[model samples]
Target chain A: MEMTVAEALVECLERENVEVVFGYPGGAVLPLYDALYHSTRIRHVLVRHEQGGVHAADGYARVSGKVGVCIATSGPGATNLVTGIANAYMDSVPLVLFTGQVPTIQIGTDAFQEVDITGITLPITKHNCLLKDPSKLAIVVKNAFHIASTGRPGPVLIDIPKDVAQARISFKYPSTVRLRGYKPTYKGHPAKINEIAKLIGKAKRPIIYAGGGVLASNASEELLKFAEAISAPVTNTFMGLAGFPGDHPLFLGMLGLHGTRYANLAITECDLLIGLGARFDDRVVMNITSFAPHATVVHIDIDPAEIGKVIATNVPLVGDVKLILKELLPLIEKVDRSEWLERIKSLKAQYPLSYNRDSGLKPQFIIEQLWNCTKGDAVIVTDVGQHQMWVAQYYHFKKPRTLVSSGGLGCMGFGLPASVGAALAAHPGCKVVLVTGDGSIQMTIQELATMMEQGLSVKIILFNNSALGMVRQLQQYYCQGRHMATHFQFHPDFEILAKAYGIPAYTFRTEEDVIKGLPEVLESPGPAFVNCIIPPEENVLPMVPIGKGISETIECE
Target chain B: MEKHTLSVLVENSPGVLTRVAGLFARRGFNIDSLAVGRTDRDDVSRMTIVVEGDKPLIEQVTKQLHKLIDVIKISNITEDEYVDRELVMIKVAAEPSQRVEIMHIAGIFRARVVDLGSKTMTFECTGNEGKINAFEESLRPYGIKELVRTGKIAMLRGSKFVALSLAQAREAESA
Candidate 1:
């Protein structure tokens, strides 16, 4: 049964039910590629860059609910995966990143194609391993997947030295991982669940603050049941968008900096704020002191550290959100709060989501058009900026786990790669649309080759404002319009770049053009780009300035 | 709100402390004291955190800690029969006239004078939280200048509760 470690790795991947692997071969990973050649069970996707590989895996994971796998060579190749890994880490996507390394003999010698990827990725990954022995390959691979997918899932990297990959060993995928230090609490304690139920029962005006965890744990049903059982309205953070149905009677939409007026007002007025699988990131908690001033916070999450990390919680239920909600639902007393529901209804009516449609080629209008063409089912990935916030504000996502955007890190250049990943993961026939800003798309614009090469059916809708929109907006608000690095005057034409990547490109100058171009782009079978030139002065309205209270939102210019 | 001791096992990595501490700080959770150190495994670290909350909230906190990707295991060893100790190093301005009195007070608390200069002396003391608190209090009257204390570290007292060995824990997780 003796075989090379590289062969063992492929075997382990097979055992884990991994059918697709995105990667590029290089000098350091020759043995792995050689081994991959002999394996027919797994299909290897040769991406143009290491970042594309990681992002493809990210998309594959997000849509399939499986750990995405990607591999790369040493040094620069491994470094290239950093941004993508950080993206997965921020959004809590589960991925297993394998990078080749120089032989152990030349590890510290600064040999060609040698890098300490484990050390370099330590900050960004949930955990990582440097494989020195071929015997540990199966165990490490198994453990990597386990760590990557379990409680508060994130990316994990395993650096296999060239020699280890070539070395001979008997391959046996460990039936179970044995890590004394790692044990995720899947079930919530009965007593704590009772306490949460009691808090829900006692509160007059309760709000369920949902976050990405709800989608990550696949707890939408539990959330719906709990929200209904307690008669509470649900408000979502950016990551929490698809966790609850937007069109539901109790849905208050997104909250915080770019949140809807109704959602923010509900947060301000609620007596009980039950945060499920959502960390109160600063963007969501504009002024921590004034946030939910009257609410008794009940924070439910898998990560214990997140309980009191941002906003204080009276009842901190630590465990899987789905499990905790399941427990709480059964213990709760059912009651109808018609009056509270009516008040929220009134608030929703008074402050419905609206944007000025008079502006030429408005980002909101483009998103609305995109939404119309796709019918709200298309997986929407966005880079960080005004366009990202606008999409979060305007897009009405009907399905759970449909909207794939960076919320935690708000990393720019995330849209293109993440969209590629989402497109790859989408159910056959579903389109993946990336609504990106001109500045954010340029960060990883090299991925254009990935789209062409993979022939992924994704629509790249670029909001070409020729500026770092978010930073520009901040400067306008805080620094008296002394636009420093926020301006991008020399930005390249996205349509031209899309053509360079062998993809059809279109440009929309007017609202009629946007309306015409979107349907054509959405209906296309292959990867395409729509460069919509937008006014740089168009600021994202209903913005809660940094450090300001939710009540202090700027509605219009 | 009663204070409870929580022992958390976390993967050894950068910014893990920040993530953990940031969570508590952001949540407005009152942390009485905290300490962290490497465990038997090179890749894993252990943290001892003391916080004031109800029994339900404390259990929830422990569960939440387990949710952190870096966090491996969380146990509320507060109710368990165990021995807990905290180490505190305090630098006191002990003038020539007060040196003997300071040394005498240190002796009463079983504290060792680890360093001494012409005008100051550093005392090293290790004991349960209460003992360290008392030692610090006793030195406060003598013009304490600086103090540093390692949060409590606890070990079970009986054979029944074997500190789940790394292999056993990993096996359970894999299972």
Candidate 2:
């Protein structure tokens, strides 16, 4: 059937089973949006801005385990998606970004609203392409999705020229993408799996350092099985929060700069460190010379480039974490590291995650109350800073994909729109929480209108400290308490903003009022927002200063 | 810090050069010299990047380069360099009196005068980097006016084995 490239794009999306997309349309994308106007099977949510659309897609991808889609016009509209695209890249989220371009003939003429988005997003994306031929549109679409969703998944861009979107083509979307040089390794080597098994057998103190790869690959079950089989403790990276059950006895919580003391202590004492789907990023592995000093490393990641990028591994297994663990499952024998568990318990008993309980509307207490109320079942998205760390520390996660926050990029203003996206894709009536700081929430606060328009039941808990909490903490410790532009002196009354967006708004200032009032707000059927005023002087603790090892972490005063 | 000559294979796509150069800039890797040209297949372009860094730095750079999807393969060719060549074009301050001496120097360096003027002569020379450097130094006394060098291009001497063997080994592994 002869059809316009724009119509073919909708058809191609249908072929890939895409149901909903987030986008903001403009001049270059009018043709595609016209086709979307006629399509009944695909639903398009009009976002307030291009960045909000991309982040909404990211949230959808993270919560639904499906590749998220977003569309934007050329030039500034496309450039607006850069931060969100880079956020997805750093966190390894699967997103397919479609941007409109200038017509074929006027590509280099610097046409109006025509930016080279493909060029702009090159390094930050998994792959990107600019379609020159209308007939090849189907193939490029397939390739974009294939590259985005497979093998250390990340964002990919497809720049469609305005003319190509208007051109006619005999549409047939390819069933599979076959690139000669793009075959990802799925099965790990037998030798390394066996070596890891042997190491598991010999080591009395072993720790499994899990990351986002496990959750992205849906290998959490395998991770649980492996940890159980070996009786090893599991500590996750910030991005890896939901990869392992936070309530399990062997769970050591997060391990990094702001990681729990138990997890850091266990890491320093471990004999065999198993890295599954986790890049030993500088944030996770500070002072590499002394990180896991007593451990022989075993790194298993799908990306070969990440294998030796940081720490050298004794056993390098490059493949899907789920598949690798499946092959290595039977080779394992049960271990009883009672003494190691004792040490972990001692550490946990000695240094528990604590906060100023009597302080005005403590953020940690609020998060703990959230965990108590929701049973750690909500899709909790957070913006960066002290509030994000507080959530990671206080909210005990029990399932994968429960925590949807930017990890590597540490992006602010990611919570509100992401929560809307997560709510839309989640199980009907599933709780989606946006726990954000006062500074971070203002970054994309316009998305609240989108949430109201879409009627998404997104619950937001604004940690209203009126400052960039993380930056202030850094300056307090390193810059001799020189507070600069971190202050939001004229911060908005978020409750009033929520009321303007036609949502229920509440204020929780006292620790008593928050604990008493939050559950009612959470249980409300429609969208609700709570402005929780927290102490501005509070900081996230047990922080290992940059370039310092985990053992050097300092606890609270 | 030592020097490393890295051969990078990349898809001949738009903005690939920017991605490569941007990676270096973002990571603060000081590139000594860089040369890029089409490979045997027009679909692929080859970049020879000369960077000054030690072993760990080179490893990190190589790993980071591999993270770029356009990059097909990268090999550090500094260890097994059989042949290296650099092309230079120089405009020398030459009058009728000094033209013979310039011509003699060109002859000694096996260069050709691609362009000529009454008072200045432009000579093109291609040789190993050391020889090119020596030729440029000799021309300095003759008041070299302007100069341009096409960095360096290097390959193994026998059988083009670097590419052939690498491809074959990858094929064997894939098979």
Candidate 3:
């Protein structure tokens, strides 16, 4: 059938089972938006800014386990999506982005609102293409989704020229994609799997270290089973939270700079560290020299580059986490590590994840209260800083894909739009909470308009410290009390901002207010916001000092 | 620092070279020299990148290079006894008096005069790094006007091509 490229693009999205797209309209994307307006198969949520659209897509992808879609025009609109695109790339979120460009004749002539977005985002994207031929749009769309969703998924961009969107093409959507250079290795070698199983069989003090790859590959159940069968304790990276159930007996809550003291201790003393889809990033590896001094590491991942990129591995298996665990399951025998279990118990008893109760309006207490109110049933999104660490520490997520935060990029302004996306994508009755800090909320404060416009239900718990809390903590420790630009000279009233957006707003500055205000915000049906005034001096403790090993973890005392 | 010659096979797609080169630039790993050209296959292009790094650093660089989707295969040819060559075409300012001396120097290096102008002479020379350096220096006194070089290209001395994975090469040997 002969149809315009814009129509075919929408049809292509429908064919891919895309249910929603978060986007903003502009001159270049008029035809595409026009097609969207006439279409019934897909719903488009108009966002206030291009960044909000991309971040919403990212959040939706993280929760929905589907390739999220977003649209923006060329030039400034496209440029605004860079941080969100980079965020998705760093965290391995699958998103297909469509950006409109000027006509081909005026491309290099620097037409109005025309920019080389593909060139600018070349390094950050998994793949990108500029649509030159209208007839090839269908195939390009197929390729973009295929590349974005497979083999360490990331964001992909397709820049459509205004004329190509208006051109007519006899369109037939390509059903399959086979590229010469693009084949992801999905199965581990049998011999290597056996070798790793052998290592697992013999170790007395073994630990199963899981990461975001477990969730990405949907191998959390396998991880739980493996950890059970082997009688090994499981610790997760900050990104790896909820990949293994936080409340499981063998679970060691997050291991990194801000990890639980016992988790750090277990890692410091373990004999064999089996890393599942976890990159040993510098944040986790306090010092390269002695990060896991006593351990022989076995790293399993889908991306071959991550296997030996940082710490050396004794057995490196490059494949999907699920397939690898499935292959390694039958060869393993459960060992009785009573002594190791006892040692771990002792470590946990000696050093627990705890905070002072006397501290005024604590962020950790608020996260715990939020967790209590939701009972681990809600999707928790957090902005970076002390609040993020507090969320990771306090929330005992019992399910995978429940704790969605920016771990790799540590991006602020993530929680608000991401929460909006999560709220829209999640099944009805599932509560979405944005646990954001004061500094972080101001970065993309414009996303509030998106929530109000869409009438989406998002409950926000703002940690209003009147400062960039995490950086302040760092300066207090590292720079000898010389505060740079970490403090806010004057903070805006977020509750008033929420009221202006027509969202219900509440503020809590004391225990009495928290008791009264939190339940009202958490239980309300429509979008709601609560600003909690936390003390300024409180910091996330049990911190592994930069450049020191996990053995030297320090507590608040 | 040790010099390592890495042969990378990539798809001949738009902005692919930029992705490959961009990875190096972003990681602060600079290539000593690089040569690129089409291979026997129409869809694939081969790049020979020479970089100086220690074992671990080079491994990181190679691993990062493989992350680019356009890159198909990579082989570090520095491990084997390989044949390496670079070609240089230099246009040297030569008067009639200096022309004979230039030709004499070029002949000793087994270089050929690819082009000649009224007062300039162009010599094409191909050899190992040492030979190319000496040849270029030999004509430097004539005041060279222009110089262009095809950076080093290398191949293993055996029948093995860099495109073959280890398992594939083993299978080929057994067959």
Candidate 4:
């Protein structure tokens, strides 16, 4: 049927099963927004800023395992999505971003709201296209979603000129994409799978280093079975948190910088480092040469480039990890790794992750309590900084996609906006929690109005430390304790701020207050905020300082 | 670092060259030369990229290039039995006295005198890198006024191929 390109774009989205798109409209995208207005099947979320829209989409994608869609107008609106796009790219989140461009005639004329968005986002996006023809709109949209959600998923951008969006065309959404270059390997080589099975059978101290790809592949069950079969301790990267059950006996918690003491130690001591859907990031693999020095690293990932890009891979299996794990499961001989398991238990006992009880109103305590209140079922979205690390450290995530924080990009203002999307994507009765710091929350604080407007029951846990705790800790250790520009001298009263946004607010100044107020805040019917004041001096402990191996960790401040 | 020639087949789409070039520039992969043109199939374009890097660096480049959506196929033809060519045009300052000597050099190197001027003679040559370099060197003493060269373009010996079918491509990726 014939329709405007904008309407056709909306129709294409509906065909792709996209329920909502987070966006902020502008002059260039007026036609597209108009089309969105006429569509009843798809909901358009009006975010405060373009960045918020993208992040919210990212959060939604992370939780729901679907291609999150976001839209923005030309120039500044497009530019504002850069960071969020990069964040998604780094973390391998599947997102389709539609940006409005100036009319084709005015594209290169430096017209108002004109920008070369496709060129700007080239390095960040997995794939991008500037749709110049009206007829190609459906195909481009189809390609965008296909490329975005496939193996090793990441953000894909489609820049539609204003004229292209307004032009009428016979819309026919392609049922299948035929990209010669975009084929992703899904099945692991049979020989390689056999080799891995043999390695697992022979291994004494085996550890499964799982990352976000495990969750991306939805291979949590396979991972569980494999770990249990081989009796290997599973250490998660920060992105890999919640991929394996946190309460499992074989779970080694998050490993790398700021990881649990035992998790890092296990990586150092393990003989067989089974890297499952995990790229050894610099943050995760602190010193390349010494990292898993005693181990034979078997890397199974979807992206071939990541195999030996950083850490050398002895056995590189390039395919979808879930499928790979499923294939290798039956071939595995159950190994009794009692000695290694006992060693890990002793190590965990020796280096328990503990914070000082002397410190007042601890962020760790709040996260733990939040975990208890939600019964480890909440989708905990967090912003970067000390509070984010605290959640990663303390929150016992028993399920995959439960912890939705910015892992690779570590963007500071990710929590509130991301929680907005997480809340929307989550299953009914599933609580969405936002853990933000005083410094991190203020970056995208306007998102509070968004939460209130949407009436999303996101439980906001603000760890007000009065300073950028992570950087301050770095300054303290690395910069001779000169805490310049890290401390916040004066901040707005968050309780009053929450009230202005028409959300209930609470302040936890003491331990007794947290014991009384935290559960009540979490249990509130609508959106609620709790400003839990913590000491600025506290640091995320057991950090593997820069240039050092994971074994050389700072246990305490 | 060794010079590695990569014959890459990509979709003949707008900005495909930019995607290829931008990748090299941003990833710090040094491109010695890059020649791109439409292939036999109009929908597909072939790019011959001569890059300077070690074995691992070349592998990294190949893997990264393969990730691009427009990139159809990549062959590191450096070690393959392949025929390579580069085109060069040189304008040498040829006085009446130097004309014969320049012509003799050009004739010996199988270079065609494509253009002639009163003060200079333009020689167009196409050959492997070595032949092109030697031809340019022989005319260097005669005061070369201008020189332009097309980057290296390569193809495998007959029967061997780079553009594989879907099934063959999958097999190649797994291999």
Give the top-scoring candidate (DockQ).
4
- What DockQ results do all the predictions give, each relative to the true complex? 0.25, 0.26, 0.34, 0.47
Quote the TM-score that chain A achieves in each candidate. 0.97, 0.99, 0.98, 0.99
The fraction of correct interface contacts reproduced by each prediction comes to 0.44, 0.20, 0.39, 0.61
Q: What is the full ranking by TM-score, best candidate first?
A: 4, 3, 2, 1
Q: Give the distance in Å from residue A525's predicted Cα in candidate 2 to where it truly belongs.
A: 1.4
B57-105 per-residue lDDT for model 3 (tens digits):
8888887887776777888999988999999999999998888988999
For B43-78, candidate 1 gives per-residue lDDT tens digits of: 667888899999667865665455455676677787
**Candidate 3 on A1-557: residue-level lDDT in tens?**
89999999999999999999999899999999999998897989888888889999999999999999999998898999999999999999999999999998889888899999999999789888888988889888988898899988999999999999999999898766756566788989999999999998999899988999999999999999899898999999998998988878898899989988888888888899999999998888879888778999999998988988888999988899999999888999988899998998888888888888795788888877887787788899888888999998888887888877888898898888898888888889998899999999889899898888888889988999899999999999999989899888997778888899998888888777776778778888898889899988888988988888877887967
* Ranking, DockQ, top scorer first: 4, 3, 2, 1
Higher-scoring candidate on lDDT, 1 or 3: 3
Better of 2 and 4 by DockQ: 4
Instruction: Give the residue spans of candidate 4 off by over 4 A.
Output: B164-175
User: In terms of TM-score, which candidate is strongest?
Assistant: 4
lDDT, each prediction: 0.83, 0.88, 0.88, 0.91
Candidate 1 lDDT over A50-133, as tens digits, reads 887887788788878899999999999999999889889988999999999998899889999788787777667887878876
lDDT of 2 by residue, B78-151 (tens): 87746778999999999989998889999999999999898999999999888899999999998989999997
Tell me the docking grade of candidate 3.
acceptable
Candidate 2 lDDT (Cα, 0 to 1): 0.88
Q: What is the interface RMSD of each candidate, in Å?
A: 6.1, 6.4, 8.9, 7.1
Expressed as tens digits, the lDDT of each residue in A90-200 for candidate 2 is 999999999999899999888898788887887789888888889988888888888889988999999999999999999887776655446688999898888888999
- Model 4 DockQ (Cα-based): 0.47
